[model samples]
Target: MQDNYQALKEAGAEVYSVSVDTHFVHKAWHDNSERISKLEYTMISDSNKELARELDILDESGKALRATFVLDPENVIQTVEINADGIGRKADVNINKIKAGKYIASHPGEACPAKWEEEGDDVLTPGLDLVGKL
Candidate 1:
């Protein structure tokens, strides 16, 4: 996801990474990890598990579950995805969802269907006449 940070930012969404590690540990890892050494987004430290508990993603082992949250400009959560350990997330999927969310926010009452791609053409505006048509 760090690799696609520019694309996400261009799509008008800020990216932040929250981890249960302390600031010192995070800094050390960030400085050492070759893959993430150039990460440009903000990294939030949740060593106390405050954010994890608030999001209800803390596990019995006191570790946060892998999760992603897309929030709108108003700070309201628009989409959320949680995964178990050993699972991974795709940046393209989240980016597409962010695009769809932004589109829906700008064009109220319209809905983007499954696998909706910003360039690909699939949007729905519901009405009584369209009932049971899909």
Candidate 2:
């Protein structure tokens, strides 16, 4: 996500990485791992699992599950993606989701389709003509 952090910000979103690890561990990884070394976004340490428990992503082992939440300006959850242990998240995908969410928030009574990606993409306005067509 570090690679596309600017794209995310331009889409009207702020990026924060939350983990159950301690701040020292996070710093260690950032120092040791090449991939994490250049990250400019905030990395939150949720060692007590307070944020994890609130988000309901904590596992039985007291670890947070692999998850990403896209919240709007109001702190309303707009998208939730929970991945299996072996899965990884795509920065581009999250960027698209953020764009879709922003569009929907600005245009009331409109909904983004499953494949909506950007500002020009089509949106749905629920009405009689679109009852069962989709």
Candidate 3:
């Protein structure tokens, strides 16, 4: 996702990463890892687990589960994705979802179908006349 930070920004989304680690630990890891060092987004320290508890993503082991949230301008959560430990996330998938969300937000009543790409013609605007057509 670090590599696509600019693309996310261009799509009018700000990316932030929240972790249970302290700021010092985060800084150390950022400094040591080449990939982490390349990230230009905000890194939040949640050592107290306030965010994790608030989001209800804390596991039984007292660790935060991997999660992603997409929020609108008013801070309303538009989407939420949570994964178990050791599972990885795909940035491209999140990017496409964000794009679809934005498109739907602007063009109300329209929906994007599977594999819909930005600026593509695969969007569907449902109506009673097309109830059984799709």
- Candidates sorted on TM-score, descending: 2, 1, 3
Ranking by lDDT: 2, 3, 1
lDDT of 3 by residue, 105-134 (tens): 889999988779886667888888778786
Could you tell me which residue pairs clash in candidate 3?
A: none
Measured against the true structure, the TM-scores of the candidates, in listed sequence, are 0.91, 0.92, 0.89
What lDDT would each prediction earn against the true structure? 0.88, 0.89, 0.89
Alpha-carbon RMSD, candidate 3: 2.1
Put down candidate 1 lDDT per residue, 60-128, tens digits, no spaces: 999999999999898998889999999988876778888898888878899898867884577888789
Return the clash pairs for model 2, or none.
Answer: none
For candidate 2, lDDT tens digit of each residue in 16-117? 999999999999999999988899999999999999999999989887999999998989998899987889988789888988888877899998998988
Off by over 4 Å in 1: 127-134
lDDT of 2: 0.89
Q: Please report, as a residue range, the 10-residue window in candidate 2 with the lowest summed lDDT.
A: 83-92
Regarding TM-score, does 1 or 2 come out ahead? 2
